[model samples]
Target: MSTALLVIDMLNRYEHDDAGALAESVGESVPNIRRLLDAARQQDSTVVYVNDNHGEWTADRRELADWALQGSRPDLVEPILPSPDVPLLVKARHSAFYATQLDYFLRTHNVDRIVLTGQVTEQCILYSALDAYVRHFDVAVPSDAVAHIHKDLSDAALAMMERNMRARVCLTDELVGVFGSR
Candidate 1:
């Protein structure tokens, strides 16, 4: 099964009320996410960055990156910046596939398995997993690579995805192992 790494909503200004705490929570996942990115590149896996436009409909990827870089914590955006070869999709909703060409893009690349990694495990990550599951894509969520706003909600979301969507909930090391062994 061909796999694609979906890095969702990592580019953020963190201007919201709980932005600081969210940033702190997500900070723990950055290293794992970096590992996944490196492994994906080494294994020639498709790397697609799905980002929220933050209500700026006219803003492109560069604009979005620039805005994120100017935020209070540019460090978060710097390391995970999408490489030139990586495709970036701007989404306005929680699900990456909602009103986006993400499904088509994955199909075009012959990707049948999706490895989800990014912020707000209980929000974007959870919704994107369901969307992918309904579309018949096998989902694998590396628990270490996703951040959460609330511990309880994140745990619940992960359980729901594993039970309802049959998503493989594993760690980054296991994911990298699979990527390498393939």
Candidate 2:
């Protein structure tokens, strides 16, 4: 099955109330995300980034990246910035599929499965997995590639994704093979 790597909400500003805790987790996640990003690109797999516009209605991908870089964590943003050629859909909500062209884009590209990576393990990742499941898209979320605001909630969310959504909640290393041989 054709698969796409969805980098969700990684272009973050860290200006929110949970930013400190989230940033701590994000520090660990960013490297794994970078590794996956590189692998996906090398294997010629489709890679798309769905990032929050941070309420900037006028923001495009570059603008969002610029804004994120200017925020408290340029170290996090610089490594995983989407390539110019990569399709980036700006999301205003938690679910990447919500009010966005992500579902249609994936359908057009014949992407039946999606590997999710990035910030807020309990929030965006959880919501996106559910939406993907309901839409009949196979979902995989690498544990180490996702950051969480709360450890307990993140753990619970992962469990829900696996038991409820049937998502593959594995490690980053295990998911690298997915980028190869389709």
Candidate 3:
């Protein structure tokens, strides 16, 4: 079963401080997510940046990046994920599947399993993962690769994924172990 990485809400508006709305929540997971993304790229796996439109119809990604760099958003997304060259950017409001071509992309790519990793585990990630699962796609989330405002929320989100959605809520170290047999 092939897997696609759904990076939800790792956008400039959320991660970057300039966009400012308490989204400064995501921490160190940036590098961890980058590592997994790089691995997916190397393996020829799909890397979908499922981000929020921030309801900015006229918002240019470049403008957002510049504003983020201007120091308004200390923790804003850097050049790592939100790049203009990445042809796989899907903008959304709540769920990544909300009016986004994400489901189409997954179907087109023949992806059955989805590896979810991003910010606000209780909100965006939670909804996206559940949506994917409800659509009959396999879902897995690396515990450390997801960051919430609090650990309890993160844990609860993972619990919902495991209990309700039947997703594999794993830690980074356990991922290799879980995938190594294949």
Candidate 4:
């Protein structure tokens, strides 16, 4: 399957109101996300960093990384920072496809399936999965790779995606095998 791994909102500086809480929650998921990234690289799957631009329209990947490194938890951004060759799409909204070239980019690369990973599982992950489903791209969300601000909402969101969007609500190891298979 032609697949892409979308890493969302992990480049955050944690400067918002719920930044600390969100950071702490997402911290546990970082290692899982890193595992997914490493597997994606080994499998030759497309790795895209779809980050929230943090309202800095002029900011590029380097600028965003620099800003994030100065935040309370620089370690959060260190492990998962996109390499220079990896495509980084700066999004202004929650859904990565909203007003962004993500759809076209995926199509251009012939990506029919997407593995979603990153922070705020109830927000960006949920919305992005909906958008991906409506756009006809198969969605796979590893439960352990996504961080959430709210437990109840996160569980509800995952259920909604699995039941409604038909997303594969599996674990990171399972997804790694799938991505690595022919």
- Which candidate has the top score in TM-score? 2
**Of candidates 4 and 2, the better by TM-score:** 2
For candidate 2, the TM-score is 0.98
Which digits, one per residue and each the tens of the lDDT, describe model 2 over residues 127-172?
A: 9999999999999999999999999999999999999999999999
Which residue runs of candidate 4 sit more than 4 Å off their true CA positions? Answer: none
For each candidate, what TM-score against the reference?
0.97, 0.98, 0.82, 0.97
Ranking under lDDT, best-scoring first?
Answer: 2, 1, 4, 3
Model 3 global lDDT (CA atoms, 0 to 1)? 0.70
Task: Please provide, for model 1 over 17-128, each residue's C-alpha lDDT reduced to its tens digit, 9 standing for 90 to 100.
Answer: 9798789878899889999999999987889999999999999889999999999988888889998779999999999999999999999988899999998899999999
- In angstroms, the error of model 2 at 59 is 0.7
Which structure among the candidates has the greatest lDDT?
2
The regions of model 1 sitting more than 4 angstroms off are 180-182
Superposition-based RMSD of candidate 3 using all C-alpha atoms, in angstroms:
3.5
lDDT of 3 by residue, 140-163 (tens): 898788778766777888999999
